[model samples]
Target: MTIKAVRGKRDGPTLFVSAAIHGDEINGVEIVRRLLQHRALRSLRGTLVAIPIVNVHGFLNNSRYLPDGRDLNRSFPGSPKSSLAGRVAHSFFNNVVAQCEYGIDLHTGARHRGNLPQIRADLQDERTREMAEAFGAPVLLHAKTRDGSLREVASDQNIPILLYEAGEALRFDEVAIRVGVSGIINVMRQIGMLPPSRVKKPRRQPMVTDQSYWVRARVSGVLRALVPLGAFVKKGAILAVVSDPIGDTSGDTEICAQDEGIVIGRTYLPLVYEGDALFHIAKYKADIDEVLRHYHEFREEFEPDAYDPANHDPSEYDEDPPIAS
Candidate 1:
């Protein structure tokens, strides 16, 4: 793994930003690159450790697993004597992740899937919750760490880590990249790694939800998505329709929402099989209209052309220094 460390003149907290734990998730790599180029680092308070590609073996081949066919993410805090994935995980966790007080693991949806920009972290921890809110994603998901995932191991060691999920694997979404960069700067300011904004705007309050589920396809067919990502759906709303690609509607199936929630993720591939996951919906207690308003506002705020560092105030909480073209 390649590591880049930028230390500020003043001592403060150490934050490690990692990407490509799933090698095909390349958006985070670009996010890390832009972050390292931001002029804000010139005045940063502590050290920023960036690992743009943690699963080098998988990245080299455009695959999501190591050469051993093991997922690097699920082998975290691994034993040195274990398999290749485990050993690599062990080295990275010890030499890099273990050395930081806080962390941000970047990710994207699985291949052929796309996720709405969101923050997934254990919100029960006060520090983690604060950082999640400060990250300023449109949605903050209260997710439990998996058995052998990086978040689990880091949390076991008392490190507050946030996982930012957006875009799709092996693809670069400009909006997602910009959001990732801006969110990191927000978290740094919140953690004292950077100064607080001189211009105080109303912080974007992300809709928080602990309940979410995947709507699966009932039959194999061509999928026609009726709802877009970030759409607020009502219980029983038709999310998509699955019918024979040959235009036979006789056995068509309408995938409907099981509960009222927001669509946070969905598959982009039109072809799917029986029981395939098609949409990810997160339930919230807030008003539906209010939630939609929040989503719309977030889109406007981070629209590709909306983020121009040159026109942005350097001390603003949501803005960072210019990144090179």
Candidate 2:
């Protein structure tokens, strides 16, 4: 529960950027680290509150849920007089999120899953849509507000926010971190909290989709993916095949895409049970060619080795207090 506030000399909108609410999602934590190092923050016009680790208990335990086995995210806008998770959420809302005019909640795929870099926002709001487009991810999902989630509460308070999802939990992906850092900076600039970047906007808009679904494993076995993440697939295209490790094709089951879409997420671990989520596809109802063009440009921009964090030091994070026995 560490919050670092970088306040600008001039008065402007306060923007809060939070990460690691699920604890195991370390990519967001790293993104905040790199974001703090940017020279742009020195000239920032507004406040940037960085909360790299929110779930201290779950983070220390390498788990997504709290010690009480409650999902911290599901206990949002919580109570000061309730469970530990609820109290923590309540404290966070009051102390950190209360003052912010805007926010960006960073995240990654759950354990054993990897996600393509994307922005999930309520596009119905013009302000939110502007921020999402400014962030410049290849995919922009018009996600609905889930009950008890931070996004829901923030929207309720009329504070527009974006959820940047990428990479996988418990690991650092350089590309995801780069995209996250740059995207946050972009949003700041878009809202006049910071100076506009010299970088140009994408030639094409992000693949905006209100529809996405998980392609589940059809059988219990070792899953082998025939396609890579970010690959576009047509309806009924084979995405993966689940087969026994002992060369038993007799029980093989091929998982096919249910719609023409892009692979937004996939399972990293080969072992899976029947009905386990294997692929998450985002359908492009229109502008498929333009979307593909943007995808290639995004890859070229944030390709591996384009940015290296090894030279930068981000060790300012504090250790959580030890629990009493």
Candidate 3:
């Protein structure tokens, strides 16, 4: 309803697509901007409200937390009597989000980390689960809602909000960005707010995993990961090894997998100390090999080679492709 919150087209179910709630998590900002400019939305049957940069201060500084050192994502549905971040969240929730029938929140891994494109939702909630499936992201996680988080607050209100995680903090990856923009459009199409999509074929629905753990470093040293995000690993596999930068004595410096699953997030900063989170893996018993294949194929469809962006340039892939919408 306000100027900062830009809405495109009126007269249909209002869908809110928000990004940069964590300030430094900006991949979503670009995704939302591109989403607003999509030509396909011309025939949209509903209002699309896009807030590209939610926390302008932290976004400018590439800081994940607000100036008050509070994580904005954890301050949702806040109060006017609270701090700056809280007030903004409260206002947006009470005014903009409250008016929407469905919502999508885009995000990325924290600083010094990278995440495979995936959706995190409370799959236990019927509506939330539906939207997560409709989102059509390469993978989906049925994570429980954290207290004070936007997803939790919205769920409490019975509003289904899908949280999309990908890329890395303070920077952007072209593939992750592409996946996010396309995913949002697919969601719009799924809800019948927009016409059917024409892009890469939709990926299979991701498995629902309730438990996840961040594999952290037990010894401080230079680290080398054995697999990247989206890679499948069997239980008891060697995930990573840490040693001195100059290859000093290797005295028990390794992290092993606790269960069979796929790597959803990993650290980029090789240098680390004891107790630093290195990998975020979700435990699942599904055909993870198929899940991994879908993850890579989803990205490959948009590129001729992951090493060469010139291969599947947007200009080249710009023909009619199967889109979720």
Candidate 4:
């Protein structure tokens, strides 16, 4: 594989965990690295293929798409001779990924954005949904699978892949890292690839959303956000407003809400052009209030400050004399 991969021992199943398919989405990259160094893997039952980075070119450039202006994640099952990104994707699919029975592709929002560590997958696929639940990120999105994605290609091969979205590109958020790491470990346990789950679960299952849309800026200016990730809002509530940097233009135009939902994701950068996506609101059926409550409680419970692997000396995990390829 063009990308670097680390494999573990055991005979149960092969599970693939990949990150940085979108170069700027570094949260997953770190998650995969930390996962590999996790002490729990000492007792892992199946082979765990951890690819900390899938799109090296874009990762180096700190951009989301490939150098050829293609999104690597969308160029899956790619041709070996297509392009730099394509070759990388092709090699990964034919090698590391093809060996897996279950997979979790981690990701984060692009520049200036943040997501609440949610699992977006095809709920109609029973196995896919089960893995999502096993992943155990606070919110689960029952999204329709998109085209040209690793998720799509893996599904074709009968491998269940759950896409975990969190944090932001280029910048790592502590909360995002903790949730993602715990979630992936949870998935491994659920698939019989790992012995047991260390992640604590809620009394009820996750809230799944069928569709989600972005709330954009109403005017070009600086933004003062009133609602953060996982906050609940009613129809017509003032989520945020576009204010002129010069404090002009009707004293800041308010961006009124168009629907009642929870903020699954939001942009971190305050400055915006008039139509830039500022908030991602996913609609749900029942338990609207319950969703928000669960999100915050879970987030607090997994405070990123307490789990710094660096301080904990993660390298202690690389002890097997570096297994051969």
Q: List, in order, the clash count of every candidate structure.
A: 0, 0, 6, 0
Taking the tens digit of each residue's C-alpha lDDT, what string does model 4 give over 1-325?
2344444576778888888888889988778767877887877886777788788888888888888899887788889888876787788888877888888888998888888889998888998888888777878888766777898888899988899998878887777887888788777777786676556555445778787788888677888898988777788889987887886767778986788877888887778887898889887658766766777678677663334434555565443221111
On a 0 to 1 TM-score scale, where does candidate 2 land against the true structure? 0.92
How far off is residue 186 in model 3, in Å?
Answer: 1.0
**Which tens-of-lDDT digit does each residue in 1-325 have in candidate 2?**
7889999999889999999899899898888887888889888897999999999888899999899898888998999999998999899988888789999999999998999999999999999999999998889999999888999988999999999999999888877887888799888988999986677654457898899999997779898899988999999999988998999789888899999999999998889998899999998768788788878888888765422345544463332111121
- Which 10 residues in a row give candidate 2 its minimum summed lDDT? 316-325
lDDT at 168 for candidate 1?
92
Candidate that would win on lDDT: 1
Cα RMSD for candidate 4?
4.9
lDDT of each: 0.91, 0.88, 0.79, 0.79
Superposition TM-score, candidate 1 onto the true structure = 0.93
The residue pairs in collision within model 3 are 196-325, 197-325, 198-321, 199-321, 199-322, 199-323
Q: Candidate 1 lDDT, tens digit per residue, 73-98?
A: 89988999999999999999999999
User: For each candidate, what TM-score against the reference?
Assistant: 0.93, 0.92, 0.89, 0.88
Output the number of the TM-score-best candidate: 1
Give the range where candidate 1 is weakest over 10 consecutive residues by summed lDDT.
316-325
| Model 3 misplacement above 4 A | 1-10, 198-203, 304-325
Please give, for residues 1-325, the per-residue lDDT of candidate 3 as tens digits.
Answer: 2223444465667788888888889889878867766777778786788888878788888898889989888898899999987898899899878888889988999888998888998788786777777776766787878978988888877888899998889886777777777778777777778777566564575656777778899989888888988777888889998988775765648788888888889998888899999998888887777766666667675542423434545665543222221
